[model samples]
Target: MIPTNRQITPETPLDSLTLDELDQLLSEKLVTLQVDLLKTYEQQLREHEETLDHLHRHRRAISLPPRPTIGQDDWHSYVYDTRPSREIASVTDLVTINFTNVHTVVDIFPVALDNIHAIYKLDSGNGYILQDDTMHLLTVRNQWTKSPTGCSCPGQASDTRCACCALGSVLCQVSASGVSNTCVEDSQINSHTCSSQSPRSLELDNAIAFEYHTYSEGVQQVVVIAKGENIHFYRLDKWGLQDFHSLKGHNTINLDSPVTHLGYGEMFVEQFGTVTRKRYLFTFGLDSSSKRYYEIVTNPQDFSIETGLSMMWDTTGTSMKVWQNGGRVIIGVQDGTNLNIHELTSDRWGRQQISLQQVLSLPAGVTSWRSYATGFENFLIATTLPLPALYLTVATIDRFLQTQRNIPRNKLQLVGVTAMFIASKYEEMYCPEIGDFAYITDKAYSKAEIRKMEVTMLNELGFNVSYPLPFHFLRRNSKAGSVDASQHTLAKYLMELCLPEYSMCHYKSSIIAASALCLSLKLLDGNNWSDTLTYYSRYTEEQLLPVMCKMASVVVKSSSAKQQAVRQKYKASKLMKISEIPQLKSKLINTLAEKSASYA
Candidate 1:
């Protein structure tokens, strides 16, 4: 039932109702705020003679943007009334409805406010009133929008994301409506009885700062309440509040002093999706004498101090206000008058421990960089050897790279050069002199080092260099299918297309050859994966489809992909200029690629 003012009172048992019931009442019912909740604090302020002057000064500082219209509602009529900027603040994106009268609005939720002392603006469309004895939580109804503080770009196709998208800047416009989807709304409801707490401190006495941290282990949410020398953490579970203080550690984490301001972690990493994953807590400590900046680091399990310009260093800041992410801080001697307002800025975030992208970074590094080794190695080794020897060099270099560990980067060149020297001796009528391979890499290595690395590569690969090449399988499949000159070269080109890609490095020679033929046929608009071709390849149409799709996606991305060496190599006329084929970019090829891409 829709509740009326007569049905509920200041003494109503709101805690007894379920959260869904509270939502229905607040959203659909008429709300009467008859109690003079803010009267005690602001009753005499409006009568003060200087109030208008202060209001006008405040009005001049705010540069309001043009009104926003979302959904089908006529913004002026439904959300805003025609009023001068000074008389009515733009709060439709923040809180409130058109007031029926001075004392009543259409909707509001209640908290037991025994003696409301102050009301403060909470981030993300949430409201709370402060009282000396009891905390009042006002959950507003708001919708989370994916509608970005959006790109600062011209919104053109060719425009790169501006610095705000890559690295956030003060110039970034963070509307009260949203800040990178950090939850700000015109009206949002997000309170759950999901949090129940009994901390070392029974009440939030002398509480100063508050932050809601995003928790990832499910739909859980954690709220941190900062008090003198202590931080009380409250969290919500999927099942709602269940033993919020249930963790083994103490309910409140004690710190050295009262935290003036706290921020969620910010790592200025360039990689996408890694911005607060490191989760370093930034705490700003401001005093009249000396300013302090601390980063709560996990690796060292200790705090690091940062030095910055003095902030109100002579007179104690009555309160400190730090902006979102990182930037200048505003400190005032008194919270109200903005007295002795000074800006404190940190030139740099304090030193932080960077996590190794897991311990496998070195092995992954060796795999990616070894291609450079082969490029240099092949110039000397592949020059005089037969075409078969080129494949041998690639396969041996792949072997040395895949099995070996702890090889230095420059040393990898020695390994690659030596592998080619081996492939040359095995495939060529006479191997090139060991000294020739050494000279090709700008004489970076001596003939003696090449000899030594040759022995080591042989030993590490277990004296077994009998790896097959994709060309071997390609020749067999082409012979069976009677592929013509252009089709054969096109199939060869597709195999080479993936040569520089480490992501597909693990596919066997037979598999690579099969997928290449399949894609080449489709690109030429020919009958793909004929019976003879599939029998020779031992890979049916079904088996080769995933890999062919992968090849098509790679071709589509090659124009913009960071690794373009293979594409560039095949751009030559001798290689059929296959990478430059306009059909390689046809919509039909791309449509074929849009299927399930998670093929093993």
Candidate 2:
């Protein structure tokens, strides 16, 4: 343990210092010493509170129960009454979902009579869930599929069969009435026909990709680009396929283009009015050179990209950042670790690029990010773990367990707990407490149980998160031999940053938080933040810039001042009442000894 000089005692020269001076002194110490920033700073308090010792006792009380298995079925049956009994389950407001976190929300929608699937919302109503082909429409009160086979009548029924066209495809569009959308499928396909194949089999040989949007005015539109590069924009209504407009830009998105990932910018209110954010469709895929681009689509007269920033690349992926003073077309990327920036500008044609730039570099690759809203003032959130690092950590854990045959299962639990604890401090803005996990475990754990599990997990895995971007940055800068240098440093910092709240499941938040911190350090001190960014993909200055500025001025300064005063008062006013601070500690030790002897 590092030695810290004690400024407050039973008696000292306290009368001379003003409140502000005392606060300033305390703030400096806390920043330098790194105390638990969020929690109350209590030096002398009650001890041996077994209830407090356990972290998760309260969790099970609040959270929903877990499920045994989540059946693989299209979600259509749940909301679709036309489907057979086997496809649906009774509705209940409380659902114990399988393989889903407690904080996540799942929505069921109708797609087709026979098939349906659910998707997690990434941004709006967002979370991550498996992909499906059917589109859920509450307006139509129906689920529709892209394949005609999905709509086959109950049992290959003849009357419901479409006789004109044998093509096994389906297309849906809204009518001019603007009330409901209609599904159009080949007339030859029967509702009851069943094939030996699974539903998700995509015919990549010929397929088109599209996007959907819902406006605040309740106007919904789906844009489909077809085989001949024809663009079809449909506004969903009661009749079908109304106000058809064909465009030429469909061909511009070539299959041969190097990029693969596709993203759409969300609509947000700007200083002028509601602005249509551009859609970002690009990729880290290697069939083409690593490239990135943004397609800005708004009323051409209203908004556009104005200028270019800067760009840089590392190992995991590439990233770009852009900003306009009161504009809402904010875009960020992290294929892995490469970073870029772009500005929204309205050119002469009212087309936006408007110009893009690459601004900073991070040590790790970035995967995803979330920016806090105006009031709360917190860090930019991002997740930055690559497959390889996870594998490495898993391997390390396996070997440790294999070698330490004498270690009990309880000890192994501690290792897992510690690894999660460390990861949380590295990633999330609001780290879950040890009590949170204990509560989730339904009071089936003890301090010994948690600590042992944490140690075992660490000994086995080394570090929970490991990735490549740091190596790329190091290699480019000639600091160390490879990315391993960054990994080694990350491993150390991750361990040092461990907090009481980390858990196995909430690792994503930790990954994001660490990435943000890494990026901040990169800008502030020019350290190996890119490596952190690579492992945690969500770190970007555009998202983090405001929060970092606030921390220096408000949070850090105020917290230090308050905590220092609390400690000083407690030491002088309270500490004198007792001979020593460790009196309760001894009592707890004695109690543990007696309990152990009784058990033996």
> Could you tell me every candidate's TM-score relative to the true structure?
0.36, 0.29
Residues 1-600, candidate 2: write the lDDT tens digits: 112544455465767566865786667566544433211222221221233323323743566544323221111110101110112121135344344332432222111111212223211232222334323321111123322222334334542332111234343322232221123334523433212111221111111122333333333333222112222222233322122222312213333423323323322222122233334332223333333433434222211122122222222333332222222234444442333433334433334443443333332333333333222111234433332333333333444555667866755555444444545444444444554344223224644566566665555556544433222332332232233433334332222122121222123333434432443344333565454454344445454343323222221232245222222222322124111233212443244324433322
In the range 27-113, model 1's lDDT, one tens digit per residue, is 544222222322332344334324544565697589876543321111111010111111222313644233221231111222112
Q: Give the best candidate by lDDT.
A: 1
Give Cα-based local distance difference scores for all models: 0.46, 0.32
- What TM value does model 1 have? 0.36
Number of the top candidate by TM-score?
1
The residue ranges of model 1 lying beyond 4 angstroms of the native Cα positions read: 1-386, 561-565
Cα error, residue 38 of model 1, in Å, equals 98
Give candidate 2's whole-model lDDT: 0.32
